[model samples]
Target: MPEPANALQRLHVHLNETRLLGSISSALYYDQNTVMPAAGAEWRGEQLALLASQIHARQSSARYAELVGEAEAELEAETKAELGPSVPTERRRNLQLVRLELERQRCLDPALVASLARAQSKGNALWQTARRHNDFPTFAPALAELIALRREQAGQLAAAEAVPRSPWEVLAQPFEPDISKTRLEELFSPLKATLPGLLEQVAAAPAQQGGLNEAAAELPEAEQESLCSELLNSWGYDPARCQRSRSAHPFSCTLGPQDFRITTRVVPGQPFSSFLATAHEWGHSLYEQGLPRSTDHYFPWPLGEATSMGVHESQSLFWECRVARGRAFAARWQPRFVAGAGGDPWGGVDGFWRALNPMRPGPTRVEADELSYGLHIVLRFELELALLEGGLPVADLPGEWNRRMVELLGLRPASDSEGCLQDIHWAEGLFGYFPSYALGHLISAQLAAAMQRQIGPIETHVAAGQERVVQQWLAAHVWPLGRAVNGEELVEQVTGERLSAAPFLSYLEAKVQQLLASAHH
Candidate 1:
């Protein structure tokens, strides 16, 4: 056996190489989404497939297993030594991630990995085309294929674990990890039962909409981009170290420890949409930037990665929903926002605020109002769960989505573009990722409540344009920990409570009630 120090060195080298590959792949994906021309989709798909196969092969190889084993043995020995129990917990956590990933990949056949990768690559183009035409049929074949591939992938993973639960649960493992179907039902069931009534009450309440109101103004694209850059810079983003671009959907990706990229989309009628999306994506970038910089744990491993998508979503939602949407933030920045868009500052603030917090139901999840956002996710969760468990057929998705939208939101999408084809998740075979959005909202609310307790009124700070205070608070309590703690432990550590929907529901209810009350008088 290699010496403990030698084993640790080898494992570190291996992990770093994996991180580099993963980062490079992510950079490619970001570029593909933002700047890659439509003509290059075929080549990009091939490139992504090759990279995916390489990463899977490397991760599943015996050499990687040996390195992990050596590190694990050394850590075990060190824990029993005179060095006390203070040894870095990240080391053990890194090994656990490696083992879990290895097990997951081992369950998936290499051929299936390649096929899934290729399908996803091609599906992206199909989705783009379908979305452009607002026609689901154009994208249906590719989406069906993607779903079939994901179902197979789920089965393989489940069979490898020797557990035969629902396929959605298997698919969800990558995103939520230990979350079970029963637990999801517990968290969602009450909201599902209670939200409709609450939404009705909100709709019926005398509207109190007097926040940031602005007339829809045409801001040039270049001007909007410049404003986005300025906003990011003010938020401490270094252009030399990070990049932002436009895409159909907004997302953030990290290429390395220092290199991060985020994309935003421009809505013609709503300029704040792009600005707020930029803030949200920056939140994700900041979390990536906050990972522990210790020699032992860095990137692409459990120690350096985020706890879960839910936690990641929490960070983004924290900045976007909690900080950006706060009345204080608007009060302070209303001038700049109006000046940039070349509109009346006073009129723009109130209109923009109301537009930002509009309570109306919408068809697209990303574009949905905060109040109705979870319902969008809930719809997907139900459909995806059914698709994976064989309770719903791919052919029936369009009708099913329309039916549920009406039932939940009392509105129906006029077309599939606003309905089934709105999101890229299913087309890209992302079956189990939807729930994290809702979970992120829940986590954000809980964390915000805790922040309020510690900082004494975060909304006041936000309104005063003291965003740095909130950012610094998160950097200390939430961001620096990275994957050092699991989801449940992280929630408990920061909030002193188990994860619950009460904080989120309370937050939502309070905001809606206040908005409704103001609209009346």
Candidate 2:
């Protein structure tokens, strides 16, 4: 094509290139997790380190800053000339976002950038082995190195922040902008106070007889895969733009504007694991696919990206917890599951729903019920604060993790794999991301309420096998907002209320009563 005459056009070209590099990094990461061989990790780390350094250089370079400056000057002139608020609003916001990101990138040392990439790659490899062997010692050194590197990173980025922030807060800002520990405490305190009591209520209830066992719940991997495919197809998963694979940990990622990937692992006995995980990951993929990618201004721009990890998680949990685990969905799909397993293991539809909505507290966070999921996040959020700010030693993590698990959920992990090493976030030096998971539950609940208010009941649509209507609502309301707002702002804008633990807690209570009522029948 011809060379761009305008500064804005030139800046678009620059951002497009930057997005290309970032997507390449994502592709490499996806491969590493899904199919890359064990021995290739070292070379992959080196490759990623090189790419990280190059991308940092491009983002922080004087030339890119000059282009951004020129674009801002042109945008201001155009905005002043315009009669109304049509083009200038989103474009102006995009430029502002770009400027802030530029400042933060400029503050980081390139060596540190490269080092962090290598550390993250190495840390992920170490974590996989360590988790598999239940060996925390083998992974502790890498975790310490990552924490030290990230602390230094936070210290550097603090200078670029518009407001004063603590080290943990600084590290967290990239995930949830304008987030503070005080706000997290305010939001999570309700969960801390209430969830355990709810858990106790479930625990104190009499156990239902003839519940599912390992043998009863087991489905072969092939059957699980088939069921997952059916679920995705029923929910609008198009293979042309989206692909599914297996991974150690379930996740979804965008390799490019059109390339979406999700992965889930089938456990030996947990028949629901792969199916629910597929739903969860596809929810993430749907959000990614629905993001603004139509115009050039959207794809290579901040507005095209996800607003926050919390919102992203809300999408996943909406499918996993809200829809897949709901009574309507269980009633709908229980027949297929029984056919796949060659037996009616769950006894009946209500029994299948109970199996899906197992309300008991558990050692594993991924396998946790709605009542206990937020507590898992609370435990991680506090431990992160303790490790990053409260001077908790790395060697003491296992003990501390176990103590918190018992305190919060009344369960203790039997091994390091199930305890401190359960999540891959800390291993990769993600200090402030856990809170978003809890925040997601809250956001999902509140949004669901709003969605129900607008379109009657979600369960009604779900029971009617009209999930497309639900997807249409979210696509119109939620996905297009993108980075125009932060997580809480998005919640308030969509739901007309500030995010809180109330909706999620209320939903959990009602669901628990329903489950108990069914048990009595």
- The clash numbers for all candidates, in the given order, read 17, 0
> Among these predicted structures, which one has the highest TM-score?
2
* Poorest stretch of ten by lDDT in candidate 1: 205-214
Predicted candidate 2 versus true structure: per-residue lDDT over 365-455, tens digit per residue: 8888899999999999999889888999999999999999999998889999989988888878898999988989999999999999999
Looking at model 1, residue 127 earns an lDDT score of 92
Candidate 2 stretches greater than 4 Å from native: 82-86, 208-210
Query: Can you write out model 1's per-residue Cα lDDT over 152-242, one digit (the tens) per residue?
Result: 9887888655455677888887788777788887888767876777777766753444443345455677777887887888889987889
**For candidate 2, what is the TM-score?**
0.98
